[model samples]
Target: MPYFKPFKMIILGFDGVLGSVLSGALDLFSFTGVSWQRFSNESVEPRFNVQIASLGGGDIRCSNRLIMQAHCDIRDVTECDLLLVPTIGDSIDKVLKQNSELLPHLVRLANTKADIASNCSGAFFLAKAGLLDHKIATTHWAMPISLRQIFHWWTYKKISL
Candidate 1:
């Protein structure tokens, strides 16, 4: 008898804000019985073996009241099998204009064979990273024009809640 290793789903956390939403979506789909892993800077009380990436200093306050002490950097995300990017309440204009700090890392990760998922405005991060070029993607309908204008090569589908 042979044993198979469990498939790991890595959720990228900037400040541990979208952890709940990403986790909840995964749960909703029952996605392959995935083991949700977070790549965060903060040291969270171990819920399920989260990998700390050492981002130097930052406060982590999730939307669902899960707080973490910052600990890791984006460079440490190489080992993740899958990547999930969730929305953050920051100035999208600035992030999109400046290409955001995490843009490069997300681009690099997307080049790999790993499955990538983004929720809400997280899709903006992916678009800025150039991952959505020639790909079909959906996002909250409110930003359709802006999104299409920014990433003209993509086919955008407006999603309504």
Candidate 2:
């Protein structure tokens, strides 16, 4: 059999993140090529090397007050196949204000071969990074107006949760 390297997946971790969205994203990607193989009694060849990356490689305090540990520092991540930004559960303004440091990294990674994705209000990070400029983007249906108001340069498609 030919050797296969796992795809690197980095999930951005920060305070004010939604607990469910963060854990759900982690579970979904981490189990991609491993779980079903186990259930079918096949060889387990995991597909992704998933990691939760925070600003300082420290603990993350979710909006729900759950504390979670990050796998690495976001500043140290030079490359990845995919970078996920989970839903922001707290006040979007407050969260953005507190995690401003992530913007530059987002822009840097966006320039790489990484596919950047976000859930709900997390798209604000991508927008703030100037990635969505003149590009089509979307968010939770209820937030289209809010996002549009803040990011008038991009076109938004409303998606219902």
The lDDT values for all models are 0.60, 0.90
Query: Which lDDT value does model 2 have at 91?
Result: 94
Residue pairs with clashing backbones, model 2: none
- What tens-digit string does per-residue lDDT give for candidate 2 at 35-136? 888999988887889999999999999999999999999999999999999999999989999999999999999989999999988988888889888877
**CA lDDT of 24 in candidate 1?**
65
Assess the local accuracy of residue 76 in candidate 1 as a C-alpha lDDT between 0 and 100.
68
Q: Which candidate number would show the highest lDDT if scored against the true structure?
A: 2
Q: For each candidate, what TM-score against the reference?
A: 0.63, 0.93
Q: How accurate is candidate 2 locally (lDDT)?
A: 0.90
Q: Give the TM-score of candidate 1.
A: 0.63
lDDT of 1 by residue, 42-73 (tens): 33233223333323334455555676544456
